[model samples]
Every structure is written in C-alpha cells, then in structure tokens.
Target: MQGYDRLAAVMAADKGLSIFRSFKRLNAKNLLYLQAEIVNCESELDEIIEEDKNSGDFFREKYSTSVRCLKEGLGDETPKQWVKIRQLRELLDKYNTAALQYAQILRLKPPHAKDREVFQRWLKENAFCSTTAEFNQWFGENDENGGDLVALFGRYENVDALTRWVFRIAIPCFYKLVGYRKAKGDVETGMVYFDDDKIIRATRVTSTITSSAIPATSMIVLYLVNHMAWRLAIIVVYNIGFSMLLGLLAKARRVEVFAASTAFAAVQVAFITNFPRD
Candidate 1:
C-alpha cells in the first residue's frame, strides 16, 4: 500500500511526521542563512573595494611599474580584490545551488519521488508499514477518517517494496490460516487488532520458508528429465524463469539478477555435466 498524508488518518501515528516541517524548516532556514551570508559578504566587499580602490598607486604615474606588477603578476593571476571576489563568488555559487535544490524540496506539493523518499524514511524511522495503525490508516476509503490513499507498496516505490508487499499479504493470510479469533472485549477498543509484531515475525518465517523452497524449485525438473539435450533445454528454461521470478519477487536490479542466475546456472551445469549420462 502507498503511504500518503494519512498523518490525519490514525490516532497514534508518529506525531513528528504529522507535524513535519520540511518546507518551513528546511528551505526557509537555508535560504535565510545563505541570503544573510551573501548580503554580509556584499557589504564587506563593497567597503573593501571602496577603501582599496583609491589607496592603490595606479592613480600615480610614479608608481606605474609597481601597479603594473600588482596588476600583471604571473605568480598570482588575481592580485587585487581576489579574496573578496572569490569569497563573493563562492557564496553566490552556494546560494545558486541551494536555490535549485530547495525548489525541489520546498514545493507546496512535492513530486512523487520526493514523497516516496520522505515517507520511506518515516517508515524506516518508525517502522510504519508493519503497524496495525498503518494498515487501518490506509486500508480503505478515506472519507472523514482520512484514508483513500493508494497502498504504499509499488505506488510509493520505496526500498524493499517487495518485502512490504510480502508483509501486507502474509499478515492477513497468517491470521486466516491460523484461525485464531479473539473473544470480544479481549483487547483495547474491542476492535480487531492485527498483531503487527507477530505478523512481521511470521512474514520473516514465511520468507525463510520461501528461501528454502525457491531457486531450487527452478531446478527440480532438471533431475526428472534424463536426456542430455532435454536436460540442457530444461536448464535454459530454468535459468530464464529463475531470473524473472527473482526480479519480480526480489525487485533486484538487472546486474544482481544476472549475477545470481549466472552463478546458479554455472553450478548446476557443472554438476550435470560431471554426472553419469543416462
């Protein structure tokens, strides 16, 4: 499920996120600081220029050679006003860069990618997605209760999106399969309270079960077919399916999928080739 501004949805969600000050705090603070620094530098440089501009001997022909040396010193390309100009330039550069970054960061409505980063960080900090409040916060129609957001998995597109999907599916399925029902008034609110901790633990256990089952599932048919050519064909098919499944379920990158598939195929091929032919 995609997370949203559902800070309004739950009664007990992290209040820090609810009152997040990304715009007011981040952009305004940086902008004001940069602006002040630049202004101060401008004032200071103006004074330096005013003072030093007339004090130099370039106005006197008697000091022409000395002024030329100051102006054209190969040893130091910028001999006059260099420090002030550099400092001003660096400040302006910093301001320019911060402006561009803050444009993305300070929008009234941020881009989805930015939201994803923010919500995902919140999830990491508070473990939001695995909570009963999170589920209820985003479970259904928004209405006055404030849900109505898309589920956070693929849509928000955070880290371990697949793992989040697995958690969502495994939690409900675990309860159903176990057929555990609490007696009425057994818990707070007397409402159905999904045990997120147990669900997460169960999801991990299910993941462990899957780790045992998969990667090998692709090769199970390898031993059933005896002919060398057919076995080779099966191996090729297995590698393709294996790679696809790994990408789909693990959300792995192409390089990761390629590396794992290559490693597995290499080992499987070695064992098959070295074995007795049927």
Candidate 2:
C-alpha cells in the first residue's frame, strides 16, 4: 500500500511537470527507476573506494606529481622570467583599467579636439590621478603664472579659477610687503628651504605680509590710512626690528640686505596702493 501511494505521488508530480509533453514518452515510474539506478551505482562506487584505503592518497599524489612535472618544465630560469612577465602584464592591465576609470571619474574637459586627444593619451600613459588637494594647488599656480590678471580672470569662467588666482598671485604679492625672507629656512638647518637665499628671503617676506592680511585687507588698510606721521614711524620701527632679526638669525651678504630693503619698500608701496589695509 505504501509503495502504491509513493508511486501515485510521483505520477502526480510528473503530470504537473508535463513529462509527456516531450517528444519521447517519459513517466513517473521510469524516472523513479532511473533515480534508483543512480543510487545503486553511487553505493557500489563508494563501497569499491572504501575497500582501497590509499585511494584518496593515490589521487593526491597523482595530482602533486602532475603539478610538479608541469612546474619542472618551466626550469629554474624560466620561472623567474615567467613571474616577471606575468607581473608586468598584470601591472599593464591594472594601469590601463585605472586610466579608463580615472577619465570617467575626473570628467576633465579639454579646450579643443587636439587637446582632448592629448589629455586622453596622457591619461593612458599616467596611471595615477591627481588628488583633490594636488588638483587645487596645480590650478591655483596655473591661474597665477599662466596669464595676466585680466586675461586669467576673464578667460576662466569658474569661481575656482578666481580663488586660485587670489591664492597664487594676490597672496604672494602681499607676502612681499612683510619683512619676511624670499626663501624660508629649514627648521633644523639655517639653510634656505628653496632656491637661493635672496629669493627665499624675498618669498618669505611677501608670504608673511600676505598671511597677516589674508581674508582681512581692511585692517591693513586702516593701519595705512590712519596717519602720514605714523607711516614713517612704523616703517622705521619695522626696519630696525626686521634688520635686527635678520642680523641675529641669518648669515646673508650685504647685497642681500640691500635687496631686502628695496623689496620691503616696494612691498609697502604695493600694499598701500593695490591692497589698502583699511
């Protein structure tokens, strides 16, 4: 009775599947018989394998021997050569993928078709993309030195370009006004951090004034406008203090001293006219 009931259930399932819909006639009983045959074959195979304890080990040894033979074919020198070739290929693939990904990610626009092509070629050659900080710094410097103020400002439509111009040009101009060195000194070494001592000193002075006046040119303006008598007084005091500071801290030549004074006076004029403190 149980066998009949099981047979009926299989028949019902086969009917639901529409096994008779096929070109060949296949029924529930035939399928059940095929399943039993599979089980029987599996059981027999397992019993045969169980009889041979070393069968698993034999397969493992066989696999290891095959792998060893294949490895040995490459030879000692070939392995290193192959490894380097593989690594280079992998790096090339990664670099190409990275370039493609970077182009999509950066979405940079070129001025002309030639420029666009050149940009794409450069992207393919260069694997790395500029970080946000690096990109900003690059743009800032480019805007400053690339063109005159009017040309740069008018040519560039983006606010970022204007901001970059201010940072690169305006800030440096104000830095010159301060009695700072063109070059900065290494904290550990008294040597200039950049190029020549003179240039470094000049840059330092300009940067210092720029730093003080940044985001608040009005204060510097007020200081300048308050009194004519006070201007010479402040200038004399600044000169004495800065000269003393330079004498104590620096090993600059007499020519450097003269250049710094000229730079300071020029900076003061520029500050007074272009970037009035008030």
The estimated TM-scores of all candidates read 0.46, 0.21
Q: Model 1: which ten-residue window has the lowest total lDDT?
A: 144-153
RMSD of each: 11.2, 29.6
lDDT of 1 at 146: 24
- lDDT tens digits by residue: candidate 1, 191-253: 234444454466456556765675577456666667889888877887787677676556578
**lDDT for residue 250 in candidate 2, whole number 0-100:** 47
lDDT of 1: 0.54
Residue-wise C-alpha lDDT for candidate 2, range 1-278, written one tens digit per residue:
23324323433432211111111122334444555655565565445435433455453234234645323433353332233334455555655565455444334222322222322333234323346443322123334311111111111123232233443455456556752456664332222222223444564565556535532443354364656556556655655655554443344566886677666655665555554434
Each model's lDDT comes to 0.54, 0.40
After superposing candidate 2 on the true structure, give the runs of residues whose Cα lies further than 4 Å from its correct spot.
1-225, 275-278
The numbered model that scores best in TM-score is 1
